[model samples]
Target: MRAIVHEEKEGLEGLKVKEMPERQISDNEVRVKVHTAGMNRRDLAVVTKRHKADDPALIPGSDASGIVETVGGNVTKFQPGDEVIVNPGLGWQENSDAPPEGFEIVGLPDHGTFAEYYTCTEDHLERKPEHLSFEEAGVLPLAALTAYRALFTRGNLEAGQTVMLPGIGSGVLTFCLKYAKAIGARVIVTSRSESKQKEALNLGADLAISTEEDWQEALASEQVDLLIETIGNATFNKSLGVVRKGGTIVTFGSTTEDEVTFNIRQFFYGQYNLLGSTMGSAEELREMLGFISDHKIKPQLDKIFTMDQYKEAFEYIQESKNFGKIAIKVR
Candidate 1:
């Protein structure tokens, strides 16, 4: 199998393509012949060793679509030659501190999908929708599920409510805009570039603004009911500014700075809720796929690169100029 592996934690320099033995499936696992793999910001962080240092020689990719080459003895859901999308997240923990149901994502602390052949536990595989291509299915597990869980499941979004999404480039935010529109919610997306604003408008955003400074002023009349903050320190304070009283804010990325300064009084007095969401459950992943299938929502791809050109792909994402998900065709 052709696999990307890191023997050390020295960033992308450690990532190299090597011919490694393909994985053997366990009694409850299934082996997939990977077709397409999606890259996330976390993949870069993991490759760079900024996060998840427990495993050194990690093959880090979470989203993938492939054909099941073989099924383990205990797996009854799928058979050989079945097309499937991998759900990188397992089920939520049975007992959590506050929330009893909280999901644990894949691609970290476990072997991932950045190779020609990969093994997944049977519970982590979902049937690919008939309408989607392999590239589209490969990108939805992490990004789309995260957006669905944040807005509809965890954030408790309601129809006629207004949502303020800080960034519009990533796959998560793009799907959030699509789903929000389908549910009759007004979406206000913020982009620093005029080109991104126009792209967001084309994708059904109610209002797209290119205000590099004081984005709150861009939303002069709307009071945000739910805010999805993907850009961290750079716009966290500004994102909180336009959110209405009793609104909720869900954050997924800490891209800029983890430490942010905000008035605690404003949160309490305004009665706002600040929440954090990761990738969603397997059930949620399947539901998101169904919605996309029904609505014919296309997974926006910024660029596609071959596995040998993985370095160039990573460099492009590092520049943060892409408007959609970056994909690498593995097989």
Candidate 2:
């Protein structure tokens, strides 16, 4: 098998593609011939040491869709030739107030999907949505699951409500825009790039504004019911300003800086709900797939690169050049 291996937490320089031994499956595991793998901000974070990993040699990818090539003795959910998508989150099986202590995402301490072949427990695999291509399915798991849980599960977003998503270009936020719009929510998005703002509107956002613009002023007539905040310190206070009184704000990532300052009195007086979320449960992944199938939603794919071009893919994402998911064609 050929795999992209990172031997140190020193950033892109640590990454290299090399021939590796094929993975072996356990009794409850399935070996997949990876067709495509999706890249996430977390993959870059781990490579750069922003996110810590205990493993010295790590295969860094969390989202992938592939065909099941072999199954272990105890496996029953899938067999050879079954098209499947990997649920990147481990543990956290069902909806809960919070993930259990032992919960961990795939592609960190464990070897991940950025290879010719990968293996995971049967419980973490799901049938790929029929409408999506392998590249689209590869990018759907982590971002779609995160967006699904953030909007519906944590934020409790409903149709006809107004929701605001800051930093619209990332995979999760793009998914958020599509999902929220599909559910009849009025979606408003902000982006530093004018092109992304226009793209969001084309994707069903009711309004798109520049982050430099005064979003609170622009949206004065229609306050936001739910605000998905991912650009932490740089945009959190603005998010607080745009959300309606008593509205909910759900945060999943801090792409800017983690530390943020906001008016404590305003938060208490408004009786607002500030929630934190992460990658979702397996059940949510299942439901998300069904939702995508039901709504006929397809993930926005920014670009697809061959495994040999992994460095260029990483560079593209690092430079914020993508409006949606960036994927690697592994096969």
Candidate 3:
């Protein structure tokens, strides 16, 4: 199989197209012929992170939508020719507050979907959303699952409330905007890009502002019941003042500074509930696919690159040029 391998070198220098022996499915696994694979920030992490690079030349991708070519005898959920998407987060089947001890994402230690063929455990596969194309569904799993868990499970968001999504261009934030609006919630978003702000409004966000604007001052009239914070140090403190009293703030990623300083007095005084979240559980992944089907919500696609163009795609994402997920088409 042709796979994009992440070699020992750091960053984009390590990415190369190579022939790798395709693994045959075990009795419990299904072999999928990957049509499209989506890129995440963690795909880059696989090459740069020391632990991941320690075992060089691993297939590094977490999101893919493909057709089941063969299913092992023990697999009953799918058949040959079934369209499926992978739940990048392995282990942790039940819906819970946190991932279980054995949990890990798809692309690091285990080989991932960045190949012509991918092997998926039966439990980690879900039928693709009917409303989406392979390109769209390919990017939906990771981002949509994270957004669903962060908003519904962790944040306990409800309709008739306002939810703030800082850094609107991310794939997860775009999913949050769509899901929140579908439930009749007022969605507010911020982005450094003017075009992204306008795009968020088109996507039914009630309010869209520049990240440069004062968070509290710009949203003075809005009472944010839930806040989804993705950008870390640069805007975390500013987002603090935007949420209403007793509001929930769920953070999944800290792209900027890992450690942030905030006023503990202000946090307690406002009765804020701060929570951390990661990728989601299997049940949540299924529910997220159903939600996308119900709302007819398609993932916001930024760019499409061919299998050979993997390096350019990685470079594009590294520069943060995409407003949504970037996919690499294999077929």
Candidate 4:
């Protein structure tokens, strides 16, 4: 099997395509012939040793769409030739480290779907949404699951609520916009680039405002019921400013700049609740996959690259040039 392996944590330069031994599936696991692999910031971080690089040699992809080429003897959910998408997160014996409530995630602190062949538990595989191509399905697990966890699970986003989403370029934000609009919520999005704002509008955002210079003034009179703060630190206060009193603020990642400091009094004074969200569970991923299939929701892809071109794909993501999810054709 050919795979892009991280030989060491020397950044992208250390990533090399090589022929590695095929992963042997255990009796409780199933093997997939990966068609497409989703690239994420965490994968880059792991490769560069910024996040987790415990293993010097590792395959660094978490989300993938593929065909089940073989199933373990005990597996009942899948079989050879089944079209599937992997929800990367599995359960743990320790309850505290377990996934919150209903969901689990893929691609972190575990072996992921970065190779031509990968193996996982039978339960983690879900039927790919019929409406999506393999390339599209590959990008859904991590991004869509995070959006579902943040908006529905933690933020308690309601149909009629006004939601403010900070930063609108990534697939996660786009998933939030599309799902929120589908449920009749008023979606408000902000981006530093006008071009990104236009892109957000095309995806059904009710209000797309440029945050080039404190554009919270655009919504000064209106208050949001929930806010999704991906770019924390720099925009946390502004995010707080736009939300109504008692509104929930769900935070996920701080992509722009980290090391955020804020006045704790603001939360007490405003009666705001700050909720921290990570990726979703495998069950949530299944639900999202079913929902998108039923609703015919499509994910926006910024670009696609083959396994050999993985370096260029990461370069595009690092440069922030792509509009949404960037994928790698692993097969």
Candidate 5:
């Protein structure tokens, strides 16, 4: 099978597509021929030093849409030729406040989807939403699940309330905007790119501001019930300034600086809730699929790249040029 492999010899260099041996499925596992694999920020971090590169040789991607080729003898939920999308977050089956001890992302120590063929336990596969194409569903799992958990589970986002997103370019933020709008929430977003700001407006954002402008002044009169922050130290302090008193702020990724310092007195004085979230649990992933199906929300696809253009695809994302999810055609 052809796969995107990262090695230590290159030590933080980009991934390259190469031949790899296919793994035989275990008794409870299923094998799928990947149709389209979704790329995320972490996928880029896997090949870079932003995240830990634990394995010298690894296939690094957590999202994919594919067709089941073969199932283990014990598997009962699915059979050959089934269209499915993978739930990239493993373990944490129950809807606890945090991921359990066994939780880990799909593509670190173990091989991930960015290949012609991929295999995982039957538990990881979910039937792809019928309304979505392989490319759309390929980008659905990780971003949608994370957004669901961040908005609903952690931030307690409700309809008729205002939700603010610090950055609008990534897949998770795009999903958050779609979900919030589907539920009738007023959405506000900030982006440095004029095109991204306009795109967010088309996607149902009530207000889109340029990050270069003063957020506190621009949104001072608006009531921010919930704020989702992903840019980390770069915008977290500014996010605090815009969120309403007693509002909730949910944070996931640290795309910028890792360490952040904010005034402690202002936090307690304002009675604000600062919640941290990562990927969703299995239960939330299930619910997110239903939500997508019910709302008919389609993924905002930025671009699709063929296997040969993997390098350009990686570079495109690393440069922060994508406005939505990036899909890799594995077929």
Candidate 6:
């Protein structure tokens, strides 16, 4: 099998496609022939050394869709030729207030899906939605699951409510907009690129604004019921200003920078809710797939790269050139 391997010596420069040994399955695991793999911001972090990996020859990818090629003795959920998508989050099986101890994401310590073949526990695989292509399903796992947990599970988002989504072009944020709109919610999005703002409007956003402009002033009269804050310090305080009193702010990532400072008095006086979330449970991933199938929602794919073009794919994402998910075709 050929896989994308990243080492500490050269960081991102060290990333390369190399022949590797095939994965072996355990009693409760299955081996999959990867068709397509999705790239995330975390992939970039790992390659850049911002996020450290315990393994020296780490295969860096979390989202993927493929066909089951073999199953272990105890694996009964799937068999050969069954199409499946990998659930990146390990542990945290059911709904809970928080993830259980020993929870970890795939693609770090464990080898990931960026290869010709990968293996995982049977419990971590789900049937791919019938409507989505391999490339679309590849990108849906991590981003869609994250958005589903942030918007519905933690934020308690409901139809007819207003949502403010900052950084509209990323995979998760784009999923948020589509999911919210499908549920009849009014969505307002912000992006630094004018073209992205325009694209958001076409994707069912009620309004789109420039992140560079005075967004608070533009939305002065509209009180957002739920604000999904992923930009961190750069937009956290401003998000507080646009949200309605007693509204909720659910944060998942700090793309700009972590450790934001906000007024303590304002937070208490306004009686607002501040919540933090990460990748969701396996149950949520299954539910998210059903929701996509039910609503007939398709993930927006920005570009597809061959396995050999992995470096160009990484560069495209690092430069923020994509409006949606970037996929790597493995087969």
In model 2, what lDDT does residue 182 have?
89
Worst lDDT run of 10 residues, candidate 3, spans 47-56
Error of 5 at 149 (Å): 0.4
Reference-based TM-score of each model: 0.93, 0.97, 0.97, 0.92, 0.97, 0.97
Q: State the RMSD for candidate 6.
A: 1.4
Q: What C-alpha lDDT values do all the predictions have?
A: 0.82, 0.90, 0.89, 0.81, 0.90, 0.91
| Higher-scoring candidate on lDDT, 1 or 6 | 6
Report the C-alpha lDDT of model 3 over 1-331, residue by residue, as the tens digit: 8999987667678789999998778999999999999999888777766434456578889999999999999999999999999889899899887889989999878899999999977998889888899999888889999999999999888889899998888888888988999899999999889999999998888898999988888987889999998889998898888888899889988789878899999899999999999989999898888888988989999999998998899888888888888999988
Model 2: runs farther than 4 Å from truth? Answer: 50-55
For residues 1-331, what per-residue lDDT tens digits would candidate 4 score against the true structure?
A: 8888876547887788888787678899989999999988778777665433345567778889999998888999888988998876666212232365544344555557788988888877788887889999998888888888898878878889899888888888888998898888999998888999999888888888877666567997776999999886788888887789889999887886777777888778989898888876666676677777777888788899999998898888887787789999987
Candidate 6 residue-wise lDDT at 251? 95
Instruction: Compute the lDDT for candidate 2.
Output: 0.90
For all candidates, the clash counts are 0, 0, 0, 8, 0, 0
* Native-to-model Cα distance after best TM-score fit, residue 167 in candidate 3, in Å: 1.0
Off by over 4 Å in 4: 51-55, 92-108
lDDT of 1 at 168: 84
How big is the positional error of residue 49 in model 4, measured in Å on the Cα after superposition?
A: 3.3
Clashing pairs in 6: none
Candidate 4 vs 6: which has more TM-score: 6
Off by over 4 Å in 3: 51-54
Query: Judged by TM-score relative to the true structure, which candidate is superior, 1 or 4?
Result: 1
Measured with C-alpha atoms, the lDDT of residue 174 in candidate 3 is 86
Q: Per-residue lDDT tens digits of candidate 5, residues 175-283?
A: 9999999999999999999999999998889999998789888987899999999998989899999888899899989989989999999999999999999898888
